[model samples]
Target: MKNYNKYARSYFMPPKTSMKWMEKEYVTKAPKWCSVDLRDGNQALIVPMNLAEKLEYFQLLVDLGFKEIEVGFPAASETEFTFLRTLIEQDLIPADVTVQVLTQSREHIIRKTFDALQGVRKAVVHLYNSTSVAQREQVFKKSKEEIIQIAVSGAELLTSCAAETEGDFTFQYSPESFTGTEIDFALDICNQVLDVWKPGVDNEVIINLPATVSLSMPHVYASQIEYMSEHLKYREHVILSIHPHNDRGTGVADAELGMLAGADRVEGTLFGNGERTGNVDIVTLALNLYSHGIDPELNFERIPDVLKVYERITKMKVPERHPYGGELVFTAFSGSHQDAIAKGIKWREDNAEPYWNVPYLLIDPTDIGREYEGDIIRINSQSGKGGIAYILEQTYGLDLPIQMRESFGYRVKSISDHLHKELGSAEIYTIFEQEYINLNKPIQFIDYSFKSGEQFETMIEVKKDGVIHEFTGIGNGRLDAISQVIQSQLNISYSNLLYKEHALGTGSDSKAVSYVGITNESGTIYWGCGIDVDIMTSSIKALFSAVNKLILDQ
Candidate 1:
């Protein structure tokens, strides 16, 4: 096993050569996209999604303008059959969209599949049979001739069954695992099916050839697809389709190249979730077109909501690093990446066209409903003042002096590494208040006392500047009481200080950090933070911290 692992590692370790070839074969547009999220994605699930979840996901696909969706294989189970019946019975199937069902050539299953789609407006019955040598030898123990017979027979049965349906029915046949199949034999089987079905110019038949398992390089796969597409006898009457799996992690490349080779349709799941590595990511492929200034005709702004529904229904967590939709996909923690993204975003904002031509941002985050403010900036051990100051400048538009940027960057690095978490905007304000703004401020909270209950009356005392100032005030809560006490003792108005509290950790014992931002007579904004187990105390401290900073700056 170890020796085989080593051999596999060595085989894949070679530097990728597909990038150079990709540029040569690049096309301006993509083909029609079909989502197999319902069928293939469900089949790969440890616990399949229920009917309600399927309905929600189906609605999402419809909303995204997918004209063709593989709803499921009705012949597999009673659950699947009922789901198809529900779509037909509830009249949920859209008029323009076509629901596709997968089945083998067996007469009984094909009939059952048709029965499940009795009232659908338009649907496609996709029939497939194993035609590759390994599948024929190991699974069916059939010869090439026998396999061809099976495929032809299945296609004939599907054609006969669909003829009786009220809706406009289309036929699709796949020589399953066609990439490794003998080219001549595969072509012969496809021709036989097309002949039996007799699809004409008005009614076109689809022959989807899937690289079910990627056994060769992407170029070889493209060559195989081109071979069949060019040699097909009734090319004018056929809709060529390609389904590429990412077993070699090149499903996207293979699908793209297949389109370049004249495949009319592509199939995959969103975020590439499916059997094995996964089917090609339709989201990635579609957005890839959008990035190149072509309309992918898909709305990605609704992707996060779709992801929420899918995650709930599938009972799977979308990894935080998944492309486009992931939490951290646009975040850059490395200093170099942050610096570049920061500059790029600024240039794009300043000029009529995007500036700096950054290496990281392929598409702007705002195009997909993500916040552009915090999208590029992240804090870690390797981060620098440029990244920190960029975040502040971008988020709040506060241009920090160079000296202040360096000083605050050191403080951010110090406490951020100690906490081992990315410092949020409030945290940044806190560090700025403590390190730069309030450097020599004498106002300090030595200690504070607060008592509150159902009665709602509170008393407070605070020590500031080495002097203990005690004041008793009655109010709704501890924070209000403290504010009243400070107002009376210090003879200063703090009506402009706005305090907001956020939890700092999980569970009952977690601390709450309060952020306070105040505008004073000079109209300068001051921000501060306070952390404590008691939220009221935290709020009071944060307000006082902001006030102290403002006074010190004066």
Candidate 2:
């Protein structure tokens, strides 16, 4: 076997110095947003959406107040062409909104793209070509001069074809993999295209520069965009757009910094669903603005429902760890976090002004559609007595004693460790009742039967310490029946008891856990829990537990 010298090569690649130059050169402004969800997002999916789903998603984008939407590349497929035709023929295009379409720099496809836009009210024809040295040599097998010719020729074709349309049309061009392209050559090509098309202040053109594959730091990316924005001749007429990919997982930061560098428009998909890693998450970007006391204009409260629709259409699951819209985004499992959130919420409730200094809360949960109940009460190994007690006190208003809270905290830690997952509020309540509330009481329920649909009748039998007590009664439900039987047999008088039933597990084999909170004449509340395969049996057990607690308190 031939032995090779593993230490022959250097560990690190030489850093590119131009990155610093690019960062210092550019400063950007907020760009007009144009969502490519219907076109680019669909193409990136394994099972692309059909016509109906496309139209539905298009309407949703329109409803989101996006004035410009990339509908599809009409010349690519028959389905795409028909979809654009449908938008035109049905008059579905909103009066103010402009539909954008993407196409290669090829003449035939450009002609077909224009042919589809005949009756459209307003449209943007986006033309792009690969311009990087690597792409020019490797992908297109063309020299620098050839690639420039391809781009300029495509722009001229778009200008001539757009003239035949009745509705006003604008031109937009992108240099694919623009960040890595030589700055001087990139400018030369863009300037030449502008000259051929004569896109001016009256007929503005968008010059979108995508960090197609992020090759360096965010500052480097910012510098590239800023350099281009400052050097472009028709600065006022040019709409500088940035489309960053998440190859290095810095797409959002890159887009944001690029904006500060002078980017005027953002092109992205919802939740950042696009090619590998994904695009800059528009949800995160928009919500970041909202959280910072800046108005993002987009209403994010409808995000969860919107995500559901996108999931169905795209057949992709939104990761639970996704920021702002994930299942676990707002859930707190840490002891300190839960304690801070609990205190924050209480302070907000008591104070006249908003409590802005809440420690664990980054943003108000209610700003989105999530409730406060679901925000802070996640149980895990790192969680503590405060979280457990908060759930018990909040859900049932049965404040646990200090010692009891410590005991319950141990139980919670055990359960979280065993399951290796966070416990929901209902699960916490069930576990607490089973371990603490019913620990000393030995009430063995033999069986319970109920006959319903008219006058409800229920019979229950209890064997306590080997002595059987049987009772028959008539009431609203099995709970009321069991309560009446217990009162009559045990001769106990209680003031008021409220019963609530919740699911232990989901789907077919779901067990029901019932909670009964009984209040005495003194207005002190005692809570109890019951669990069983049947809901009625659970209710009866819960009621009995509450009664037993009432007697103990007395």
Candidate 3:
């Protein structure tokens, strides 16, 4: 707060106003996505990736459907130059994909950058010069005219180089810090480059306007992009592009709004990795469109694989809470959120909805290699009955009765709260088995033989306190008969027994799972579960489980 006097707004607003981009609610189509992961992302790493890693990353970008990828500033380093040459000399560059290389306005750099592109089928020779007022006054210490000449000279050099180059080449010009530059000056430099390249429908030039430091809000950047899109010379021949960094944490927003403002392409790194705060996240931008019913054209179906490779090569961990890509992004830990998500998932499965309208989830996690049972309804102290029950039904096929689910939910929450940790599906299953299923503490099951006559006659043998006993009882059903034998012989008084059963799955190995609930003398409820190959045995076991719970509590 005390340093407020030191900061001032460095971004410039366009001179005229036509806020047409504000009218669009969402992006209707995917932009031409150019991944700068190798160039922008690599440079930002604490330990920049080696040549081998760069090659792997380049291949990954191709696999992910990037048509244009900024490989590196080939003229800046031997590694960068070697990487470019490796792609060309090894014939790794795909015929359809174009590799773009960055270069400054200087001649030798431009010349060496051009040399690296020899034998390539197609390449983009990108030229850039800083045109911001701050760069002019402080960094470059040059007048506006001098800056314009630097860009003009670079354009001229690219023209001469392209004439002699062996590969098919396209020109791209960026007023590097476009957002901080005056609109008129940025427009002038780009048009001058266009005048030299003479871009047409067949060879459209990309005029990338980069928010190099992201000095303003996203809307201001959108207005600047609109101004550039409207005023750039040879409008139809230009692919208006934006490269937004995340200094203000709005890179995704800037790219989306810029596309709505008539820009045709977006140059960003995956997961927003780049210098300073980093470039816009192409993954988020693309998936945003995908969630809105538009095709992003990029395959994110296996995002975990992508994340593994990205982390291994980049040496940067994707935050657990990062949008779409993080591990816990789809997981719900809050009770209310879990409940709604559980209900939403069940509704979708039962109704066969055409669209993804799951609660709290913008897109189905399964659409990107995440599961609902394991990844969606995570259990913690805040988890609820719906979530616990959903996990049971989805993971283990143990659909508890509603009342039993509520009772089991509180038991799970209490355990998780005491342990101070989240419970996984397997852990929850273990707890269910240990605490409720087929429990025979204090009273144990030995043998049961039933004969149906005027009523159900059952003879059951049980062991308690190292003693074996036998009892006979009659009731309307086998479970009721067992309950009557236990209450009458053991004096374990309980009533209002409720039971439900279903096959765990189909086929010979399928087992019956039964749940039982009973009310004790104190009006307190106890629940239990049983699993067995025989439905009758499972129902009997469930009754005993409920009795064991009641006895243990008493």
Candidate 4:
């Protein structure tokens, strides 16, 4: 904050104005995606991927439904050249997929790039030249006309090479660092390149505009894209593409707004891997469309697999909080958020809603191969009763009563708070069993038999202080009858016996689980849980567990 005067805005604006992209609410369709991981992403890595890793990643991109993949700058290195040759010679490239390779405006580089494409079925020869003002003034020391000549010469060379090449090939040109170049000059160079390629409907050309150095807000990039889209030559035959970097941390935003501004293709990498921050993340961009009900065409159903491959090959860790694909993106650790999400899930189930409207979740995690039990409601000291009860029902099928859930919730939170660590579902269940379910403390229920005629009558046997005894009592219900016996035999006083039960599983082998709660003389509530093959036995065990808790408290 103290060094504010040292930096100035380095971005340029177009002379003409068009704000039409602002009116659009969202991208309505998926764009043609090109993964540049082998080229831009590989070059940025401290230890670039080897040939085997590159092959593995290429197959991954193909499986993910990318129609175009920039394999590498084939003329740049032997590894790149060998990889391209290998894909072509071994017939590993799919019939519907196109491989693209980058080249400079120089003739020999263009020639070598074409040689790498030899024997390939379909390919894109991407040509690029720096057109930014800073590059023209300081880097190249050339005028605008000279830069145009470089692009034109490259376009002419590509035309001649394609005529002689055996494989089917297309042309793509980029005014490198387009965002920092004058919009009119950028348009001028691209139009000149189009003059040579002569793009037609049958052989459409790709014109890529790259934010080589991102230097402005996303709106400025959108406006620049709109200007080019409106004025580019042979617009019908040209596929407008954008390649945005993340120097300013707005690469995703720039790509999205640029797409809404009429660009048809995006060139990026998985997880946005590139130089100086990174390229726009293809995963984020495509999933953003998926979340809005637009089919992204890419398959990310098993995103965990994708993340594993990406990290294993690229040596880049996907942050735990990364959007849609991270570990914690769907986790609800806060009490309020967990309660809302639990209720929202139940509302959807009860109403059978067709769309996903759960609170704090834009899309269902299960859609992307994430689970609800562990991934959604993680329990910690910050969690609440709804989450704890939801975990119980989901993992072990013990639905606690509303009041009982709160009681168990506080108990679990206390243990977690004392240990200074989070509790897993199994750990929570173990705690529940230890503290509340079927507790055989000072008073233990050995067995119970009941007869219900004019009134419910029960005889129960229990062990108190290591001694066994029998007691008889009569009441309106089975649980009440047992409670009366415990009060008379043990000399304990309590009231308000509340109970709930549910079938834990299905078929003949299923078990029944029950919860019981009661109030002590001091106005405090005690809760218990029981699980057994018989519903009646589970209920009795739950009542005895609650009574033992009361006696232990006394």
Candidate 5:
């Protein structure tokens, strides 16, 4: 903060205005996605991936539906060179996919890049050189005319190499730090490279403008991209591309806005892994389009599987809060969020909603192989009645009554608060079983037989305080008759008994579950649950469960 005054803006605004990208609402179509994970992302890692891991990661990129992937700077290392050879030698590169290799404006590196591409069906010979003013002054110490010659000579080298090469080749050029370079100079270098390649419809060149160091907001980058898209030679044949770094934590924004500005391709890494803050997150960008009802053309249906392999090979973890691919991105722990999500899920099922419009969630977690029970609503001290009840009903098929749900919710929250940790579904269910269901103490159900007469007659035997007793009472219903017998014979006074029963599931082995609530003189209601094979027995047990709760509390 103290040296903020010394840090002036390094990025240059275009000399001409190109702001039409602001009119577009969102990206409606998928771009030519190029995963630079092996080259750009791999270089950033402290422990870079080896040849085997690189191969596995490449297959993952292919499976994710990327048509273009920058395999590596083959000329930079023996391992990278061998890896490129391995793909070609083994016929691992698909027929439709093109592997791109990076090289500088040098003869030997360019020749060795072509050497690694031998026997390949198709490949991109990428050439780059730094053109930024700061780089020219401090790093390369080259004038604008000299810098143009470096790119021109490299482009010429690529054309010559491709003429003698065995495979079909496409040419790509990048002004290494495009954003920091003046917009006019950026255009000049790219056009010079395009002229050497002489691109046509059949052989389009990719002019990738990288935010080598993201120096401004995303809008500025978009304007710069628009300026190139408008002025670049062979505009119809060129695939305008952007490689945005996350220095400002807006690489996705830069890519999205760049596409809106008429860039045709995006070069990024999965989950935005690369040098510094990393490349634009291709997964986020694609899925952003997906949530807007556009197909990203990339397969993210099993994001977990992708993440597992990525973390294992890259030795980097996707943050728990990372969009779509994170462990806790879809998980709700706040009471209000959980409640709304619970209601939203039920609303969808009840209405048979055809679209995803859940309150807090942008897309259904299941769309990416995440579930509602464990992944959507997790119970903690902050959980609410709706979420806890939803978890129970969705998981264990216990549709608790509304009042009972409120009472049970408090019990769960209190225990979770005391434990100072979140409770898993199994732990929550265990608590339910211990605290509410089939509680037998001070009063217990020994046996019961129900008969229908003028009113329902019940012959019931019960154990009260370790004593066995038998009594009879008649009322309008069987439960009423049992209640009358208990109140009179055992001298237990309770009223406003409410009961509900349901079949746990549809099967011969399925049992009946019943819930009971009894209000005492103090205006407090005690709740209980019972599960049995017979409906009548379950109800009787339920009444005794509530009675035991009332007695224990008294």
Candidate 6:
């Protein structure tokens, strides 16, 4: 922070601006997605992926619906050249999928890049040259006309090499470090290259504008894209694309707004893996469109599996907070968030809603192969009644009463808070079993029999300390009859008993779950749960458990 005075704004704005992109609401349609994971993303890794890993990643990209994949910069290293050869010779490249290879303006590199592409079904020979002022002054030390000639020469070499090579080839040109280049110079070089290629209906050229070193805010980048998209030559035949890096932590914003600025394609990597802060996250960018009811034309339904493959091969961890694919992205730890999510899910199900309108969730976790049980309502010290209750009902088939849920929620939260850790579903269920269900204490129910008559009569046996006691009670029902006996004979003062029952899950061996709540002296409610194959037995056990709980508390 102390050296902030040394830095200045390095990015340049366009000579003129229409700001037409500002008028657009959002990216209404999906862009043609190009995965540069193997090329740009792979090069950024600490230990680049091996041939086998690159092959696996390419297959994954093909499976994920990417029509164009930048396999590698074949001219960069022997590993890259070998990887491209493996894809071509082994016929790993799919029929509809086109593999792209990057090359510089130098003839030998361009020639070798062509050698790797030879006999390929289809490929893109991506030619790039540094056109930024800094690159000209410090890196290459060239003038404006000289840099434009570099791009033009590369563009010419691409066309000639494609003619000589025995494969179907497309041309792509990028003015590398585009965001740092003067807007007019960037346009001049790109136009010079377009003139060399002369793309038309049959031959399509991709004019990739990369924020190689993003040095501006998102709006500036969007305006830059808008200006270039309007003035680019052979505009109808060109597939205008953007490849943004996260130098400013706005790669996703740049990609989104750039799309609205008439760009037709996006070149990025999964989870934004690349040099420095990485490329725009294609997964996040695509899903952002999907959230707006637009199909991003990519398959992300099994994002967890995709992430697993990404990390396994790339050896790069997707942080827990990464959008869409991270482990904790769908988890709600806050009490109010959990409660609102629980209620929203129920509302949607009850009304049979047509859209994903759950509160606090941009998209359904289940839709992306995540679960609502453990994934959504994760239990922690910050968890609330609705979330705890949701976990119980969804995972364990025990829906606690609304009032009882608040009491039980606090109990679970206290344990989690004391333990200083998150509680899993099994642990939560264990807590429930220990604290509420079938609790046999001073008032343990040994056996009971019911008789139907003018008044419901019941004879029940119980254990107190180390002795067995018998009591006869009469009331409207079996549970009420036992309650009557306990109140009268034992002098236990309790009233306002609330009970509810539901069948847990389905099939012949399914258990009946019962809940009971009783208000004791001073108006405090004690809650209990019971589970059995028989409804009456479960109810009786629940009543005993609730009563014993009160006795223990007293």
**Using alpha carbons, what is the TM-score of model 5?**
0.98
Worst 10 residues of 2 by lDDT: 7-16
Cα-based RMSD of candidate 4: 1.0
Residue pairs clashing in model 3 are: none
| Clash count, candidate 6 | 0
Question: Which parts of model 6 have CA positions greater than 4 angstroms off?
Answer: none
Model 6 per-residue lDDT at 383: 90
Candidate 4's TM-score reads: 0.98
> Which tens-of-lDDT digit does each residue in 1-554 have in candidate 1?
45665543111211222223344546567687788999999898999988988898899889988999999999899889988899899989888889999998788888888888888888888999988877888899999888888888888787777778777888999999887687778888998888888888878899999978887778777767777787776898889999999999899999888887778899888888899888998888898888778888777876667678778877767777887877788888877787778777767777868433565987877788778556557776677887888876665444554544565677788888998888887677666655533222456654566566753454445556677665665556666666666667676554655556667667998877676666767665566556678876677777677667766777
lDDT of model 3, residue 108: 97
Off by over 4 Å in 2: 1-30, 355-357, 401-403, 418-421, 434-554
Pick by lDDT: 3 or 4, better one: 4
Any idea what lDDT model 2 has?
A: 0.79
Q: Residue 401 of candidate 1: its Cα lDDT?
A: 47
By summed lDDT, which 10 consecutive residues of candidate 3 come out lowest? 368-377
Question: Which regions in candidate 3 have their CA more than 4 angstroms from the true location?
Answer: none
**Number of clashing residue pairs, candidate 3:** 0
Cα lDDT tens digits for candidate 6, 1-554: 59999999998888987598888898889999999999899989999999989989999999999999999999789999999999888888889999988999998999998988878998888899998889999999899988888888778888888888898888999999999998988888898899999999999999999999889999999999998998999999999999999998999999999998888999999999999999999999999999989999999999989988999999999999999999999899999999999899989989999999899999999878898877788999999988888898888888888889999999999999999999999999999999999988877888888898988999988888888999897999888998898899888899899999999989999999999999997999998888889998899899888988999989
Each candidate: how many clashes?
A: 1, 12, 0, 0, 0, 0
Per-prediction TM-score: 0.77, 0.75, 0.98, 0.98, 0.98, 0.98
lDDT of 2 by residue, 376-486 (tens): 467788898888778876775555545446656887889899999878888987787665343335555677777886656777788777788777877776577777777
Model 5, residue 532: C-alpha shift (Å): 0.8
Q: Backbone clash tally for model 4?
A: 0
Please state the error at residue 436 of candidate 3 in Å.
1.4
Q: What lDDT does each candidate get?
A: 0.77, 0.79, 0.91, 0.92, 0.91, 0.91
Residue 19, candidate 5: Cα error in Å is 1.2
